[model samples]
Target: MNDQQNLMIKVVLDNWYSSVKRSDAIFNSLTDEQLLQEAAPGRNRGAYLMGHLTAVHDAMLPLLGLGESLHPELLEPYVKNADSKTDNHTPQQLRQFWSEVNEAVASKFNALTTDEWLQKHTSVSAEDFAKEPHRNRLNVLLSRFGHLEYHRGQVAFLKEKTD
Candidate 1:
């Protein structure tokens, strides 16, 4: 890979790593009850958010060619009700799940080539926005990161409320 591509990859990977670390640290502070508590109406609980974040990593990993797609059905759940669980698990279980997801995300990211990073992949179609011919892989990754960050904020807010 060229120096510029390598630099970009490093920047993206480093930023992602930092974000994940910060998120995990924040999540670690919450109690099991707090993680499962619903912060607002029609919103997912912390457990659901954790599941959803991992699910996104699971889904995106395959698209990046790091692993096989295990659960296509999980795509919808990740986007919609990832954090809205009917039953709750212990804090240990939640942390284990988060670890698995983080590993998967890191593994997938590590496997990417510069060309693959620049390649395009189709993302979810939104009727509300103007129809686009296609969405790139970079855009897909960015959108997932943005979504995670938004939910991370919500998780923090919920944490504060419960504290």
Candidate 2:
């Protein structure tokens, strides 16, 4: 890649990490009681949302051609259904899982090269990606960043609850 291309890739990655850090701020603001409290009526609570975000981040490992998940068991419990028992795990355990998984996601993301960010992810073969190159690591990062922000918005109601 040329200098400008390399710079652009780093810019995007940096912005993506910035967003994750902002979400972490919101995630860190919760109380043990707030973890179980619903961010809003008719919605899943903070604990479930934390688990779901962790599961999503874990899925990105294999998707980014990194490696197997550190928490594959989280899939069914967190991703397969949103109606999981709110008390399935203690608040402290859920908080630890959230922190651990996000750190794992960041470490794997840092291992990728600038060119690899433009390459097709593990889900698409090179031939197919050749036909549609927009489906790349950069794209996944953009979408997942949006996913984090979306849940971050959901959790914003926690502050509202406290107010």
Candidate 3:
């Protein structure tokens, strides 16, 4: 990796961490009652969004060649089904899951080299990645960052209920 490439990777990773930090702040601020409340009428509850984001981030471990998912069970409830169709664990349990999954993923992320981030993630075939190199691990991280931010906004809305 050249200096420019390394710099670019640092910038992206910095932004990724910033997004995570913001979400973390919002999640930490919410009370259990607030989390169980819907962010908006007819929309998902804060607890559902928390679980969904954690499940998605958990899946990223294997996708990024980091490790197996820490919470595969979560995928069935949080990702494969709608919020209304699924029953969530208590807010405390969901918070534990979020912290565990994110810490594990973050450790794996910190261990990767700049070149590793540019390499193709596990989902893509070598031939396809060769044709479209942009489908790399860093790209996946960027997409997931955006996904986190979207749901974080929904969860943040629940703070109004508390106040």
Candidate 4:
């Protein structure tokens, strides 16, 4: 990639990181009690949403060629599975997972070369990706960043209940 391309990629990553910081602020502001409470009258608890976000981010590890997911256990309860009374993890544990997963992802993301950003993701084959080049590492990051923002908004709604 040229200087211009690298700068563009940097800007996108920066924007995504800014949203992650915003989500972190939201996570930090919630007490354990608040995390177990609903954002609205009838929705998933804050704790569930937090775990869901962590699980989704963890799934992106392999998607970006950044190695395996750090928390596959989170997949069922928080990803493939929906919110229910059965979620066994505590708010504290989910918060820890959230921080560690995001930190690891950021580290790997930062370590990528310009060429790596254009490479096919882990799940996509070179032949398939050649035909559909949009399925690249940078695109994966962009998609997940949007996912982060949507859940961040959901988590933010919990403050309304408190206020």
**Which candidate number maximizes lDDT?**
3
* Model 4: pairs clashing at backbone N, Cα or C within 3 Å: none
Report RMSD (Å) for each prediction in the order shown.
4.8, 1.6, 1.6, 1.5
Q: Write model 3 residue lDDT over 25-108, tens digit each, in one string.
A: 998888888888888998998888989999999999999888899999999888998887245598899999999998998899
* 39-76: candidate 1 lDDT, tens digit per residue: 57677778778777776777776665456654445456
Worst 10 residues of 3 by lDDT: 154-163
Q: Each model's TM-score, in the order given?
A: 0.76, 0.92, 0.95, 0.94
Q: Whose TM-score is greatest here?
A: 3
Instruction: Give all candidates' CA lDDT scores.
Output: 0.70, 0.83, 0.89, 0.87
Model 2 steric clash pairs: none
**Model 3 shows how many backbone clashes?**
0
| Model 4 lDDT on a 0 to 1 scale | 0.87
lDDT for 4 in candidate 1 is 93
Q: Which stretch of 10 consecutive residues in model 4 shows the poorest summed lDDT?
A: 154-163
**TM-score of candidate 1 versus the correct structure, residues matched by position:** 0.76
Q: Please report the TM-score between candidate 2 and the true structure.
A: 0.92
